[model samples]
Target: MKFLATCPKGLEPLLVDELTALGAEEVKQTASGAEFSGSLESAYAACLWSRLANRVLMPVTEAVVETAEQLYAAVQEVDWSEHLDQSGSLSVNFTGSTKSINHTHFASLKVKDAIVDQFRDRFNCRPSVDRDQPDLRVHAHIYRGRLVVSIDLSGESLHRRDYRTESGAAPIKENLAAALLYRAQWPKCATEYPSVLDPMCGSGTILIEAALMKADVAPGLLRSEHGFERWKQHDAQLWQTLLDNAQQRREAGLASLEPVFFGSDIDTKVLNMARANAERAGLSAFITFERRDVKDMAPPNEAGGLLVTNPPYGERLGESSALMFLYRGIGDALKSRFGGWRAAIFTGNPDLCQAVGLKTDRVYKLKNGPIDSQLFLYTLYRKSAEQLAQAEESESQELSEQAQMFANRLKKNLKAMRKWVKQNDIDCYRLYDADIPEFAVAVDLYGDWVHVQEYAPPKSVDKVRAFDRIKDVMAAIPEVLEVPLSRVVLKQRKRQTGTNQYEKQGAKGKFFEVGEAGCRLRVNLHDYLDTGVFLDHRPVRRMIQQEAAGKDFLNLFCYTATASVHAAVGGAKTTTSVDMSATYLQWAMKNMAANGFSDKHQHFIQSDCLVWLKKQRKPQFDLIFMDPPTFSNSKRMQDVLDVQRDHVELIRLAMRLLRPEGKLIFSNNYRRFKMDYEALAMFDVTEISAQTIDPDFKRNTRIHSAFEVRWP
Candidate 1:
């Protein structure tokens, strides 16, 4: 018998080796599968033992098919009675297409028509189409106008391990997961019965496959039937012998299986699914499932084991930044906890894998459904404390010539800024703001904590080299600044669009108190891209305080209401803060309450800043801070706002509500902002961008632009 074992793309070589190992002869590899010469028993064994094969096919016939009629005629020549009785149920799975057949479903129907017509004309009975549990599962492939028809020995694709009735978010196909484990050398490890773990195991696909391999259980053992079972030439005795041998091996293997299998997921529901899947796989007693976050995962016991998982890839919308943090956390946890263990990470995003910190020893290319992915293998071993300290010293000395220069520049910047920060009584100020162009992160000290925002490198920069440079900076910052690693928060700063600024990046809602200008404000480091307070806005907030005394102050687009709190602290008679987001408004209220400014006179209103500005009766404030977003198309807004185009009208509207002596501080962070001097010629407009920028943000002088407008 000639058997073909089909698999996913890029897995043909592995499938070929697997088929050869399973007693297949004359094995020849193909693009997505392999063809081999073997007996009926070998074909049966392939269906049961070949983990990577999607299905085992027995070719019935082949012919040229230039059109749909030709395809039907060619399929009709296969002699259907040999595989299925005329009354038995059957199904056809058509793949590929020709010029005459553009859709697979149409091709499948044509083949079904041919088989039904042939049976009806000869035996006066036609097989009914049974898509589910078909007595004869026919597979037809058309490539370059030629068709080959075969019977699917495996009733369904072998990926369906029959154990996973439920799956978590973005589940990987079982066969692909098995390939990843194979590439990780888990099969070899199974012989030793070494421990196995999936820290981010969504539904235990990897753990179950590992257990099956370790227990010498056939992949198809759980299935009640295969497509060949109902055939007229079926070998019942041979199959029973194979089954009995498999069952006996499973019993013997399970008795001596020493490797402990552990699975953990952050979500308990997914962990429960894993437990149920293990139970259905008949390996429940040998595996342990727990609910634990990836970062909290530690070695199950003292014995080193294989740590493997398929972590999220951020392919979904609005998940890149969060997944980046998750990957970084996973790396950190592995570095701190999983010493002397072998690790493998399967991810669709290789860029995210770079953030894992650990070096990869090997990488295997594979596909997860349609997404191309990689499995990275590494050995997690940590040096002793003394050796680590020595390595640190060696790394510092081994810094490249360019990196040494960058480090020296950072040292110089920090030395120059210390006296100024001390004089200003600022606990949090920029110590290094990209002093070296090669190092593009702006480092700031938030009390004892360090907040570093990595500026996106330009297209001309080598990203890999840039990432290495960034790592150098991160490693040097804690040592140079003498701060704990936990106190360092690194975030990538990217350009925002629409209401991305208003979106919550994390759900932690963890906040810490930091003192600024004699005011205690809550700063959230984990929740948003912008830390609760803008460090560059220190001078601007101070200017607001100096100008706001015994006056009605209005703050537009008041994010977190930091500016309003500053105005109130400077003794504003009445303060009103308006923003579009209820979330930010709530945060604003908390900031005010935190600063002992909870009086009713301090108000926060959730409304579109533009609409609210138009509704203000007249001259309602002596001082107004109207710093709108650079661009906004929020659903709650009446219209899209482009600061460059609408600044003239925006300033005019504010001037109408400004008293003759009142000042409107209009500000934006648009990189290139030009004020319409001719349109607002009636009012006195003075650009204070230079004076408002703190020393920390002086390098990027356009970090924000502020102008004081008043009606004379």
Candidate 2:
């Protein structure tokens, strides 16, 4: 059959590549889609594995339709009875480009009328319009005054994936989320020592998708019905072969994938939905589901892992104040507890990034519907005081002179930027916050994200001054952004780790609140130079109130335990918080008690959370959450904790006490964490980070990441 596989815009190449790999013939690209010809098997293969397409459209006819009357006449010329029976249900969908026909709905209506009229005249009985559950779905499009008609080979949208049993507000499209993971290079996460996580794992779409990818499970296996199933030309034997092939693939995938899926959300309903979805997909023993607030995410064990999440950006769903609140919390959690780990956060709102605290290394442009989105890759680094001092002492005096020279030059460049802002409409804009090449330092007044560039020492003061000029040029960049000066924050860089103390200097960065969503996180940005919030985990935090009631919450690492605060708000009965930092533990306790958790039901332990786990006499916990730092050398604990180095061991420790069917949620921020497949063979891992991100930091990676431990 000759087919055109339609996909989202700018994804034609991906479809073409897939068709070529499937051994199809004459694969060609189109502006809005792609075309290919192949045997039935090639078509089936495309349906099973193509990740970037929307539907498999099999063209039935092509005609020139000049006007509405001609369009109706051409449609009536086709034999509609060949596809749909007299009593069969049918629906019409249309798309049009720059031509006389502009409205999609009108085109669809005309095509539907033509088909129905034909069936009535030819078969003496017309097929009824059943848009909701059409047995035969015909699609029409008008491009360059030419109409192409085809049968919808896919019934439900491929993104429906059938893995989600339930959903939270603002859920991510499953396939789209999976595509994002593929773009991020997913195999590395599965192989890393650290587990992948979605701290905000809303409905668990990304988590389930990641799990399927890791396991190499066929996505079509979960689909109960497809468009071709009801078509008159449907072949039973061929479909069976496809099904058998898919099954074989699953078996092979199972043999290959060491299932390790972890999902966390504040909403109990979302967790329950995730649990149900996993079971439906036959992943009952492949994933663990939990109700956890992102703020209080503690490692179920001491091992660090990868954190891949989708935080919130208010542009799509809510107000700006609410978005800001969540962003603040996200920044706090990564700085306080997820250090040494890496994270990828996706968001659409660039304005509220002040919350994630950590500097971004790479930012990729993406799109969700019409809204422009971005993916930020953060390599969360934790350098000890000794390391900082050593670096400071290692630099030569000449280097210091060059660094000073760079600063001076930057001041000079700002002169031009100031002029541009005055001329432009931008009032609140970014003057100089991060991403200056010559300076190797940047600060945004509202600027919290840092992009550092590597550079060499200058030959002279003039050369050094040129480096500063680059920064000045950057300061003027706000004018291009159209944001105002008040909105643009500029200052010397203040980061957790850098080249040296002399190179970077600043007082405490500004401490801001989360959002206007009726939540307050008591976090300090000074002691650790990070605001007390995990912006990436905002969605998961919002999810708690819906699911946390009457549940017992376990938080490990519990740095400031902001997630604990969310769990308490969600009405958890007994919350146990553990951490090695006495000061942070104190804050966690304070956050809990402030949110109505009393000494009776809420408890805080100031000790090595993993070490204390050895004495675990607790039978089973309803919800288990672990968000450990990527690396930490605590005063109380002798050994250093590296998230990527010890995740499997930590997960095993947490599992020892998990009750039957209980959920264990773990997350970390090791950007390039490689899971130890040998160690995680006994359990299942799922990545649910995409759904976890909320509105404030929607463009940023929500959590470092999350994994669910599901077992048979």
Candidate 3:
């Protein structure tokens, strides 16, 4: 007979392996489940021994079902007498749908009517509908107009091992915990390490599952009932024999099992619940539950073991900052206390995994309910106290030759810009822009904090050497800049395509204020690739302030609306900011409000600049500042934007909105940009790229290209 074993979506391969090990034949993988041919005894063994399956089903019949009548007729063709008696109770679980049969509940009603009508005609009576504790549970599935019905052999998804009566918030399902352990190779680790630990164990699901596997206890034995128990075809004698064998094996396995298990949680109430769960599972003696934080976690015994945990993944905004410290503490505790051990961490937020600071040996992708998650495995080596001290001392020692060269260059640039910085009262400026070819990075000073962006090296560069150079730069920055290591934020800068640059890097939601040209702007160093304020555009903002007085101003592609804020502070009559990103527009409003420009005249519009500009038919602005990205294929835009190819059209549209004699300041950061002089022969255009470069950015004259477009 053909049997179908249903499990979580990502565990189909594991389930196939499990069913084959249980004496199944012709095992095949399917979406969210697996299929195989097996005997009645093999099915029974799978229910008792398989730890990953949610439900084991036996197919009864299949047919082409397009309408409700066909579905009813197909279900009625099955031999009702062989499956259930007239006096028994039954339930039908319907899934999937077709074009003609769109409602699952209506389809289930038709199937139920067919089954009862057949029984009533044959014996003058019908089985009653019992959703709970039914003698027979029929499952109907429709896919692409084909319907296949089956009998649910193992009733309530096997994840409910029946041992967890109390659970905490967002507890992991029992079978998923088993799958994580399998991915971590916990069974192999148990033999070599002779121990297991969960630092954030809630309700002891992982711990109890580990104990059941180690003690050779059948997961099905703990259940009070099964779907096959009340069926007409149940074999009492064969099932009793299997149960007897499982009992004997359980006793023998428990006797020989010697590995210890430990679980801890910060909540006292959850720890109590975990202990109660272990006691109910009959493994309280083998496992220990304690109330403790992850920072204080230590090994239970002298023998190092496997440390597995499902730490909280910050699902909410602003929660990642705290979780970063939590993950770091977990890494620190593992390195200091649980040396010579293997570790596994399961989390939904993969980006936060970098905070752990350990190199992962293996990674497995799985799903926790609807959230896509990952399981990272690592091997931790023992570090003595003396070795840790020596490492710390070495980190603080003298810089290498290349590092000293980078430091001396930074010092020279700072010395050159000291007069300019003081005369302008600047609190943020570019300190370096890849001045040295070997050390390719951009360093900017935002008040006292430093932001360093390491540009991606070319393919010809050795990756290891480039990585070492990055390390040297990081060490040299704090020492040469006279700042604490904690205040220096480092980021990797890659060539962005499409809208990749706008995607968030972290959920810290940490924003700080920095003054520039007499304007206070909010900037976040950790959460985004670019801080809220663009330091390279300081000269442009200053020019806008100088030229704006009682004039209607327009800022296009106004990221964070910093330019708009400068215009409003410069006494512009009204300011309008436009961008596609709602996040940046909101930030722009905050910047305007911080500068006391929250009046109705200060408008922040969220729209694609191209689409918004094309819709305007009147020229209303006196001064317009348009700074667009060099390339963008954002889905929100109606068309792709390549400044070189589209600049002529963009300029025409902005000029249409420009009043007579008004100026349009246009700029882009594409170094290879060329002017389409013939296309814009109707308007007077002059290149102002040289005038826009400040003393701080004189080293890289091509940092940006600027133009002043005006009507003749």
Candidate 4:
């Protein structure tokens, strides 16, 4: 008889070895499973003792199938009475697709119809379909033009070990946990150390699987059901003998089990779940569950053992920054505590894996549900005090010359900005802006935190070299700027279009307050590419404050209402802020309330500035400030905005709202922006860009262009 043993992806080779050990012949590996030819005892043993296999399938028949007619004919070829009678229930699982049969549901229905029609033709009645607990489960796979059908020998997936009644959020599947243990060589390590631990063990999946492996207990013994129980060919006598042997082995194995297992989680609720699950698995005496954080995890005994854990991967955007600190803490704990032991960390985010700051001996790619994950294995070896000091010295000396130069330049820039920042009581300012052409990054200081944005390199630059330079920048920032790794937030700045700039990078929802120009502004460093406050606009906001007293102020494109807050603080009679983003408008309201300016006199309008200006018929403001993006094609706008081409029309609309004596200050960050002076000859427009460059932004003089427009 030929059979197939199915498992998760990346565990096929292990399944092949397992099947071969269980008295199977010609065991060959395939995608997500293994195929072999064996006797009934061998097949039954695979369904009983195989830990990695998800299901044991016995092939009934196969045929060339292309259309629905061909599929029905193929399934009808199998004798219906030989496997399942008219009184039994059956289920069909169909996978893969062809051009003729595109949907799995349609294909499965055809197979079911063929079997039922055959049974009706032989007898007077047909079997009913039972999806939940079928007496016989038929598995079919179609690829290209071939169909292979088999009987599912294991009713449920092998991962359902029947032990876990409750699980925590994003629990690792049992089969994947077993695969990780196999990759970490836990079977061999158990004989040597006789101990195991999981710092982030939710529901105790890994620890329970490890205990089963070490105790010589069959993974399927706990399950009360199997697919072969109701089949016509099931051997009750042979199965009972195998079951008796398994029962005896489990009893003896538990009595002599010497290995100790420990599991811990920061969440007390998950720890409780783990305890309940262990109790159900009948291994509660060998395992200990504790409520402990990863940072506080230590060795359970003086004897070192294997430490395996699956940490959260921060699946949401904007979460990696916070998770980086968690990964760093895990690394610190492993280094400080678990010396002369082996450790395996599983995660879906490989970038977060680098935060561990440990070199891996092996990395195995596996799937955790839909996520492509990796198991990073490390051999922890403790260093002597003198060796640690020498290692630190060696690390500093290993810096590339380019990195050393970047560090020195950062020190130089900080020295130049210190006195200016202190004298002006500045809480946020630009510290460095691409001073070294090779190192193109903008470093800004927001109070005590540092925000770094790396300018996207040109296509002409090699990607490898560009990434290396970025690494150099990251390494130098914390050392030269005197900040911790967690305080340094790094982002890559690229040319954005179609509201991409406003898109979220993470979901941290963390905002900090920074004082600027006598106004408190809320800024988020992780969630978005650009922080709430623009440092180069310090002088621009200051100018708005000086000219805003006793005048009705209108702010266009009022992102986060930073400029409106400045104008309101400058004693504007009424401030009306307009923008197309409700998110930013809400943020604008928060900024107003943060400054204790929540009266009805201050309005936040959520609309395109162009459309809002077109609806106004009379002069309603004495002072106006408009700072538009270079290009926008957002769907909410009636039309696209190109600053250079649309400025004349945009400014014309704003001037209609301005009084005859009112001043309209316009600014944009387009580097090559050209004003339509010939088109707007009715207004006197003087360029005030140079005057808006504060001490901090002096080097980047063309960072923005500002103009003062008035009646000629």
Candidate 4 residue pairs in backbone clash: 317-506, 317-507, 318-506, 318-507
State every prediction's TM-score relative to the real structure. Answer: 0.72, 0.52, 0.74, 0.79
Rank candidates by lDDT, best first. 4, 3, 1, 2
Q: For candidate 4, lDDT tens digit of each residue in 1-712?
A: 9999999888888788778878899999998999999788888888889888898999898999999999999999999788897999999999999899999999999999999999998897999999999999999999878899899999998788899989998998888888899899977787656689999998899999999988889888989898998988889899999999999999998998874899989888889999999999998998998888787889999788899999998754334445665787688677767777899999998767777878899999998878899999999897788876775576557558899999999899889888988888999998889999999989899988999887877779664466568778878888887889779888777787888767787667989899987899999998887888888889989999988999999999988989999999999999999999988888889999999999999998999888888999899899999999999999999999999999999999999999999999999999999999989999999999999999889999999999999987
Tell how far residue 562 is off in model 2, in angstroms. 35
Candidate 2 lDDT tens digits, 1-712:
7998877654566568767977889999997568999887777777776666678888888898877777888787778778888899998888774356667787788889999888788778888888888889898887788888888888777666666757877776775676567655674555543456788888777777877877777787777778888888777799898889878888898776644667788878778887888788777676677887887775443355556778767532113333454665676666655656667787887645645656787776666667687777776676687765664565322324444555454455455456754453222222333234545433322232222222323435343244344334334433333445334332222222221211212233443433213445564333233345554555555565456688887888777777777777777777788887666676676666566566688888877877888778665666677887777665567577778988988888887767766677787766666667578888777776666643223323522676767664
* Candidate 2 Cα deviation (angstroms), residue 201: 0.8
Candidate 4 residue spans exceeding 4 A from truth: 39-44, 81-91, 116-136, 162-172, 198-204, 221-248, 262-300, 309-339, 345-415, 434-441, 453-510, 526-529, 546-558, 571-586, 601-688, 702-712
Report model 1's TM-score to 2 decimal places.
0.72
- Per-residue error at 80 for model 1, in Å? 8.9
Give the clash count for model 2. Answer: 117
Clashes, model 4:
4
Report lDDT per candidate. Answer: 0.84, 0.65, 0.88, 0.88
Candidate 3 lDDT over 508-613, as tens digits, reads: 7888888877788999998878899877788889999989889999999999999998998899999999999998988898898888888999998999999999
Candidate 1, position 25, lDDT = 99
For candidate 1, what is the lDDT?
0.84
Off by over 4 Å in 2: 10-16, 25-32, 97-105, 298-305, 316-325, 328-342, 354-361, 380-712
Name the candidate, 1 or 4, with the larger lDDT value.
Answer: 4
Order of models, best TM-score first = 4, 3, 1, 2
Worst 10-residue lDDT window for candidate 2 reads 495-504
